[model samples]
Target: MNREELKALGLTDEQIDKVMAAHGKVVNSTKDKADKVEGLESQLEDYKTQLADRDTQLDDLSKQVKDNADLTAEIDRLKDENKTATADLQKKLETQAFDFALDKALTGAKVKNSKAIRGLLDMDTIKLDGETLKGLDDQLNGLKESDSYLFEQETEPTKPTIVNPGNPNGGTSTGDDDPFAAKLAKYN
Candidate 1:
């Protein structure tokens, strides 16, 4: 139905004009509200994108923190292992020193011949009978140097005397009559 038909039925010209103007104003207001709602929706989408980015960044930082903690724990474990290894090595060194001291004492008791002692003795007073003897002497010396307090307790106050085991002239051999002297003479 047309506004003219409604006016013919009951309304006047002024009333019809007023009603049309009011309807136009309501339509314009609705269009303005719709525009505002669209702008707000676009802003909400932007905020959602920002929130997603922040969440991803937080996750990455959490992973990095966990990794750092793991590395720190590993370092602590390695340090503890190193400390245990050092203690074990020290104990082994002390044990070897005591055994060497006992072996030297036994060898001195068994060998009565003086020439043999002279022949075995090196310039440093360490026995050099064979590769095995030299190795034993080196091990003993290393232990002594590493543990000075133990070395002092092990070494006796009296110096050991060298005796000759061999006698070329079939006479009683002494430290002075050592036959191996000639072999070491050139090196000295």
Candidate 2:
């Protein structure tokens, strides 16, 4: 209430001064409390934002760790596959080299049906040496000798014969001494 109104209501000046001082103290106290609450609310918001950022960072780190593990597993698998493939390649090369040596040896021995010879020969025991090849050659020669019927036998061509209907022995016919033509000429 206005000081004039309070005075008109028969309030003494000392009582008015006491009431005003009490109201002023209450307003100041409320303002101070509101300011403190506002500061605390601001700090709480900052903490919440920091927590969100930390959670995002943690999620990113977790993903990176999982990806690294997956990558390491993949690398190990690839290394194993590479080792297997390399071993297979080496084995294939060795087999090809052995086959090539066998083929060359057969060719040098002038063996027909080399594939058959290869089938008959023992791959494990066959050595790539001069004596071994000579033995193989001897075996081939023995097979050729025993199986001579396998080779083509060429025969001598027969002489061609000439036949003449006019003469039994290809002699010329004597039309000049024909007795039938002489009779026909007399009739004409």
Candidate 3:
């Protein structure tokens, strides 16, 4: 590998010089190839490091995308539930308003047995329209003409809910409110 080692293998000076020149060509070619390989190995390591970092970034982005999708789905579900709850609450409010209005109307009509009259009145034709009940007035008038006994007489006054569920005429046939009816019941 060195000039001194070649000189020690003693031929003539010219022959030694020629042999050293040929040996230099082969050794320099091999050294150049080894240097190029080392450079390539270092470049390969750099590329590998870059690829690993990009992979990690890609994984994080993918996880974020999945989380966003889950949140969107949850938001959609809550919106649907809210819409259903709002609709149910609106329906309940409308029903209560109608019931209150119907009670007030029956009381104003002087209905003696409210529960009895309510059963006789046709409900299918009734509808609430902005604080007014459609088709209710006509139905009430028809009932007043056909079933006049269900209302308070012109001279006598009576309570609206004068009847009970068990007995449509009144709560008791024993007539607890009248002394004559009570005496008649005792005789019977």
Q: Give the alpha carbon lDDT tens digit for every residue of 1-188 in model 1.
A: 45987576566676677667867865785586567656656755665575566556555555566658876676556556655655675565444444344344424333333234334434354443422344445544554466444332433333334454785457665535466876676579
User: Model 1 compared with the native: what TM-score?
Assistant: 0.29
Tens-digit lDDT track for model 3 on 9-34? Answer: 54556666777786886688558656
- The per-residue C-alpha lDDT of model 3 at residue 96 equals 61
Worst-scoring 10-residue span by lDDT in model 2: 151-160
Q: Pick the candidate with the highest lDDT.
A: 3
Worst 10 residues of 3 by lDDT: 156-165
Arranged by TM-score with the best first, the candidates are 3, 2, 1
Off by over 4 Å in 1: 1-13, 68-188
Stretches of candidate 3 off by over 4 Å are 1-67, 156-188
Greater-lDDT candidate between 2 and 3: 3
In model 2, the Cα lDDT at residue 161 comes to 44
TM-scores of all candidate predictions against the true structure: 0.29, 0.36, 0.46
